[model samples]
Target: DKKVVLITGCSSGIGLSLAVRLASDPNKTFKVYATMRNLAKKERLLESVKGLHKDTLDILQMDVTDRQSILDARDRVVEKRVDILVCNAGVGLMGPLELQSLDTMRQILEVNLFGTIQTIQAFLPEMKAQGQGRILVTGSTGGLHGLPFNEVYCASKFAIEGACESLAVLLQHFNIHVSLIECGPVNTDFLVNLQKVELGDTSLEQLDTHTLGLYEKYLQHCDSVFQNAAQDTEDIVKVFLDAIQSPSPLFRYFTSGVVPPLTQLKITQPDGSQCIRSMSKIIFSSEEK
Candidate 1:
């Protein structure tokens, strides 16, 4: 039987690349379902692989926030069990924490965390019955560390990490694998789209006047750092492929070069207080100099 893989957020970035790669692999027989929130935006994605591998790729509509949509998509494949499930749909919300509304927080969590879980739940019964399947959730470096202006996005990723951790344990007995891919900033439209949000006058209102003044001075500096930290989306897609195919896959894989050292530092450091003290001194000293 040919293996079937389902991936969300297939319109761009890592998800797009993964769909193309899996469909192109001749050694393995696969049916790749590349799903997106809006199918209309996927024409370029479809065109990119038009003549290359026509039979393997199928574009489907899936919005993580909508239960009915997930069920409908599941119904299409309910008879054909999914060999690998990639929960990759996500969104980014950035700004001063106080300026972020409760609705924004809810929406992020709904899409990034709850949506992934719902997809898993929707597919898990069939996978469990088969006694074999792999589940991969796209987490983030932000999941492991908190960063400025990304509180809501980070919170949602953190929730994903925690949920997947428990899920891995719970599914161990069934021979169903669950892995979290903790990725870094990729070269994608994520950052560009994030900048387009209308912050309004309240963007500055959320901060203390003095803090806002300081932020204005450092905003350019921060943006420069973020722009330079970009990694190739294909690198993340490769990691996802390895996680799916490896005989003994890890429970979690970090795709960014910086994540390993950061993970080590978090473990070796005694507590959050010490880590904060160290980070504060480094950041302040650099600014002062």
Candidate 2:
């Protein structure tokens, strides 16, 4: 039987790539329900899939922040059971914390933390009854360690880590696996889609000059990192495939293969000060170390 998989945020990036890969599987191993918040944006997903994968793929409209939409998507599943659930829908918010409004911060949490939890909540009962399932969440390095201007974004991802870890402990008893695919910068539209306070914007006019200087440096650092280190979405999908195929999948899979050096520092240096200093040097220092 083809494993029934439902993935959120299939409009683009890792989610789109994963959906395309699974739907195009030569062995026909998976039946994919690739969902996005806006079906209007599905043309890109469809275009990427190219040739017909009629039997293996279905596109559904699902707004992760809306409980009714999640439930509606679940109800539309012809198989009535999701063997694998991928909660990959999330957004990013960047800028100094002081510039962030309550509504903007709430929007980030709504989609990144609460949306993920809600998606899992909708599917948990059925998975429990089935006595076997896989839950894969798209996590971030920001979650493991903080970033300079991504305070709200990091908060949301960190919350997801907590939620997933708590669920993993209990779900193991039900033969269900919860895995977090921790990603670093990836070649995606995330930079374009994120809510950012740009330099010279009217909003920045009232902000302090020191903060403004740092923000400019952060932006440069961000561009350099993406140009030099961002992985393709295909690379991320491979890690997801490994997790899905494993009989005993690990709780966390780093897309870069091992914990990044900076992220590792957090574990080795529990004091937290060292990690902060290192990150500050990397982003704020005029010269890259």
Candidate 3:
């Protein structure tokens, strides 16, 4: 019996990569429902899976922020039985917090935090009743560390970190395993989508010079990380495969060498002040030199 695996955010990047990877499995281990916010953007996904494993994959329309879309998507899945649920949908918000509007911030939380919760709520009951299932979320090092301009993004991921950790314990009783795939930079458009300071925006014009300077430096820092050390999508799919296939998978899996040390600082230094200062130097200090 093939596992019915449903993944969100399949329009591009990791979600798309993972979906195609599993769907093309020669053994036919997975019946993949690759979902995204809009069906129109699915052309890329369609192109990737062409002539290969076409029967195993289905691209469905689902907006994580919309509960009805999620419910409708679930209803469309076979038996409504999602043996593995990958909450890969996320949005990025970067830039000076002051420059961001309340509406935009709410949208981030709605998609990244509340959206995840709502998706799980819709499918969790069925998983519980079935007595066994797997839930893998695309967590980030940002969830554990506070980055310079990614305050809201980090907060939303941090909330998910806590939620997944807490739920892992409760779900253990039901033979349902939960894993958070904590990764560093991956070769994806996600970084490209991070907030860029608009030259004509009046809001950014009001920020202090130092804040603006830091924002510029932070963007450079992030770009450097992505350019120099970002892993390919194939690299991350390997970790996902392990988490899904292993007889006993860990609660957290780190996908890149670059992210481990970033997460360790907080653990090694209890106060977390050292961790913050260290990161501050990485993003802000290099500009001095």
Candidate 4:
């Protein structure tokens, strides 16, 4: 019996890599449903897989933000049951909070928070009845700790942490496991895909000079971190595989293999001031602490 897996956001990044990897599994261990909001973008996924493994791979249209689309994709699942569900569809928003439009913020929450929950809601009943299942969420360090310009993005990820943790407590009773794969920067199109306030954008013209300076610094820091530290999507997929294969999978798997030094501050210093200072130093080191 091949494990039936459905992954959201298969147009690129971790989702595409995971889909290709699972479908190409030498043992043919998984039947993968690699879904995306736009099937038009599936050529990259198809190209990556080289048009092989028809039996192991299926593509479907799933716009996580749309309830009907999620249900429609679920109905198309030939197996009628998803043994593994990967909610990897998400977008990022960056800039000073004051400059972020309400609509843009709502869009982030729609896809990152509500969409993930909706997808899980659609599949929960069937998985519960099956007596076993795995739910893997692609989390972020931003969720676990604050970043300079990613307030809303972090909030959405943090919300998922709470949601998944709460569900884990109940799902254990059903022999289902819920895991969050907390990722740091990954070599993906996320930077390109995110909604960002660019330096040259006209909107920045009205912002205070101090904020403009900080935003520039933040962008530089972002580029440096991703250039030096971002992991490949393949690395992230391996952690997903670990969670899927483990008999007793952990509730949270850090792709870096251990807790990050900065993130550990949130745990070690509950007052939060210390963590705030540390993060500030990392991103705005040019300015005085």
Candidate 5:
């Protein structure tokens, strides 16, 4: 029997790479429903799978924020019985928290948190009926700890971490598995595509104008010290594969080399305060040099 997989946010980056990799496997019978917000933007996705096996990859339209799109996608794949569901669609918001708009925060939470919940709701019952399935979510290193200029993005991912943790317990009885992939900074267009939301009349701007100055100084320093810190997309894809295939997969898989050390420090260090303190010193101390 062929396993059916549905992945959201397949227009580019890790989602696109995963879809391509899965399609290349000849032994494992797969029908991959690669989904994105806009079908037109998936030219690259289409092009990547062009020469490979026919009918193995199907590109579908899905906007995580819209219920209608989710329902439509569900209808298309309802017959196949999805064996795996990858909630990979997410947006990043960069800049000081004080400079962020309420709308921006809402949008991030909507897509990264509520959107993931909706996806689980729409698909979990089907998986339960089938008796076995896997759910992989793209969490971030930021979800493990806070980062400057990415409070909203981190908050949304943090929510995902919590949601998936609870989901693991809730779905265990049904023989379904839920896992979170805490990926590091991969060389992707994720940062480039962040949506800019205008902050309305508020004290946030005044606070941002002050903090932005500090952040600008720190960013310049971090950029120099962390020039070689980016992770490869292929490495992340390998971790995703492991998570999906493991006989007894962990509740959380931290994909980056950096994340494990940081997570350990957070756990072992006394009071759990030194982790952030150390990170802050490394991140902001360059300004002094």
Candidate 6:
């Protein structure tokens, strides 16, 4: 029996890569329902998954932020049963806290935090009845190690971490596996999606020079880090495969390189001050620090 795998946010990035990889599997182990918010944006996904076993893949419209959309997509799946559910649909928000609007923050929470919870809630009961399932969330290292100017984004991911942790223990009773893929900078459209609050924003008009200066430095630091260490979309897809195939999946899968040390700061130091100082230094020059 082919595992019925449903993934959200397949318009681009990790979601698209994972959907294509699984659908095109030579062994045809997975029957994939690759979903995105808009069907029009699915051209890239369509092109990429072409020539695969036709019956193995189906693209659907699902907006994680919209309850009705998710329900509609779920109903379309055969038997209303999902063997594997990947909550990969998320939006990114970045900028100075004050400069960011309340609406933007709420939208971020809506799409990234509540949106994920809603998707799981919609499908969890069926999994409970089936007595077996896997939930893989596309979490971020930002959830583990907070970064300057990314407070809103970090808040959303951190909440997800807590939710997934709580669910992991409870789901174990039903033989359901849950994992959070705590990825670092992946070379994806994610960066483009980040609301560069400082860029082309009239709101930054009132911010002081010192604050804007820090933002400029933050942007440069971010660029340098991503340029030097960002992983490919395929790299993350491989990790996703490992988690899906494992009989006993771990709770978290972090992208390789820089994240481990950063995420371990609290455990290693016990005091939060070291992590604070480290991030501060990275975001600002030594003199500014």
Per-model C-alpha lDDT, please? 0.78, 0.95, 0.89, 0.95, 0.81, 0.90
Clashing pairs in 4: none
- Over 1-289, each residue of candidate 3 has an lDDT whose tens digit, in order, gives 8899999999989999999999999899899999999899998988888857767998899999999999999999975799999999998888888888888889999999999999999999999999999999999888989887888999999999999999999999999999999878889889666655554567878999988877877877888998998999999999999999998889999897345775787788878888878887888886543
lDDT of 2 at 164: 96
Q: Name the better of 2 and 4 by TM-score.
A: 4
Clashes of each: 0, 0, 0, 0, 0, 0
Q: TM-score each candidate.
A: 0.90, 0.98, 0.96, 0.99, 0.90, 0.97
Sorted by lDDT (best first), the order is: 4, 2, 6, 3, 5, 1
Candidate 2 Cα outliers beyond 4 Å, as residue runs: 287-289
Residue pairs in collision within model 5: none
User: How well does model 3 score by local distance difference test?
Assistant: 0.89
Task: Kindly list the per-residue Cα lDDT of model 4 for residues 1-289, writing each as its tens digit.
Answer: 9999999999999999999999999999999999999999999999999998899999999999999999999999999999999999999999989899999999999999999999999999999999999999999988899887899999999999999999999999999999999999999999999999988899988899998999999999999999999999999999999999999999999999999888898899989988999889888987955
Higher-ranked by lDDT: 2 or 5: 2
lDDT string, candidate 1, 34-107, tens digits: 89889998986777677577678888899988988988887777437888999998888876676777887888
Once fitted onto the true fold, the runs of candidate 3 whose alpha carbons sit more than 4 angstroms away are 257-259, 286-289
Which one wins by TM-score: 1 or 6?
Answer: 6
